[model samples]
Target: MFLVTDPPEPPATDAFVLEPLRPDLIDLDTEAYLTSPDVIREHSCGRWPVVGFGREDNLPLVIRHWSDHQARRAFTYLFLDPEGTSSLGCLYVQPLFPYLESMGADAQTLLRYAGGATARVSYWLRQDSGPELAASVAERVDEWLRTSWPLDSYLYRATPEEEFTVSSLDRLPLDRVVIDLPAEPHSYLWWSAQVRGGTTRMVS
Candidate 1:
């Protein structure tokens, strides 16, 4: 339910919309984002819930997480079809501190704020959707974020060595920025374009 000032051109499937998750929506979210071990691993960097935990335990956690999102602690969204009945994908948007800390960066690295607010962003969509939809979702959501959030720069992490990832990130106009984080497993790229008043263009 973000207030998009200037929405980007609609995706090929314009029926999709981004919606915030709630307790009642837990089953749908779980089914779409955490259906199986392989699905969880692919989307969550190989981290899954504790062993023996069932949906009963998972539901309450999702409720609490949604509460945190409402409190601005963290943000997560579900990409829903036009009918708003099914989830097509998931997106996570959070500040850079937790990400850096999780990567085992030093305190200074975690504390440093470059430029304006830096938001760490990532997404996971169904492979059946094909590359076009993936790129479309990223672009549309990236534009919405730039307009709706207090962000001046975006930090995107992916294994650039992978051809698919490189193509996906290029859709967002994110270019590689040099940095070293021995503990991190992937390359981090920063968007080198300026997003102002709904338009994005190369800076410098």
Candidate 2:
């Protein structure tokens, strides 16, 4: 018993928009264009917890429909914890779920976003290298990104000539745009989506 009325579309959890986020605020308010007090306390409040996903062959690859478990739509937002943005810290968003429930698409968006993704040398700290040592590299990489992203997208890694620190925020595309929140810095190794939750099946 089969009837081919209309095939079917992909899944909202897939719809996404990557806007610069304020470190002091929670996930994009989808309300205010700038930071909000309520968002800060609810999400950031302080370098609280960071949820990471996707893989970076070079740039962040936002996988559409992260899985069947998620609920809301998501995207990456880069922000700092003091009051500005950081070039070193990368934020990657997961696929949307609600959108799928709405009979939306997941593939086309992922494909499109992937085509537009690319890591631009927005800012970098070359404390180990020298002052502005990354200027050339940044320029080169940014150019490559401008081209590559439109095709398959890309990610850029801090070269050996780059150094990352608090001062790195000074070179953002926007002027002192990011806001930092109060929080105790903690150390946690970044992992992939697969390793995030599933228990390691330590087969003895």
Candidate 3:
């Protein structure tokens, strides 16, 4: 922490911006990262650094701060720089596969791109921040990532063999059993080949 230095004034922009979440060293405290999991405590696939983030004033960061207030821990802020206030985004990084967990099945597959270290960013804004201002803030972030992180750093979707890192589970473990469920209870269990779009079939 920077010892709660003087709050920064609102950044002037026509779009968004992103910053890194470095705990040590002198960080302005504007980095975007996923705070926690909707299910598990963590979604660690590998390691990622703060890459992108955002903040929309209309949807200010009031909720996050409030949650932190309840927990008495610093809330997870986005890497996006809010317009103004003592409020600032705190971004961080993890891995690509974990980030997909938040995006659902279709999104999870995207994790295959993450090769080495990946980054998960967030967007944050103060209660007073607005859309225009937030948009401006978010744009700056995109610009930052374009310049800062190399294309290879965030290739999460790439296979390990391709990127030299096996991300997803390969062969099934002995203890696990696959089950097919139907949308309706009365309906016969509808089994699709490969769970997704593969040829392996458990039920014909």
TM-score of each: 0.72, 0.21, 0.33
- Candidate 2: how many backbone clashes? 16
What is the alpha-carbon lDDT for the whole of candidate 1? 0.59
- Whose lDDT is greatest here? 1
lDDT of 2 by residue, 25-125 (tens): 33222112122322222323333222331123212122332221132233334323233322222233333222222333245433322321211122322
Q: Of the pair 1 and 2, which is ahead by lDDT?
A: 1
State the weakest 10-residue window (summed lDDT) of model 2.
Answer: 187-196
lDDT for 7 (candidate 3): 20
Colliding residue pairs in candidate 1 = 15-82
Off by over 4 Å in 2: 1-126, 151-204
Total backbone clashes of candidate 3, pairs 3 or more residues apart or in separate chains:
39
Candidate 3 runs further than 4 Å off:
1-85, 99-111, 153-204
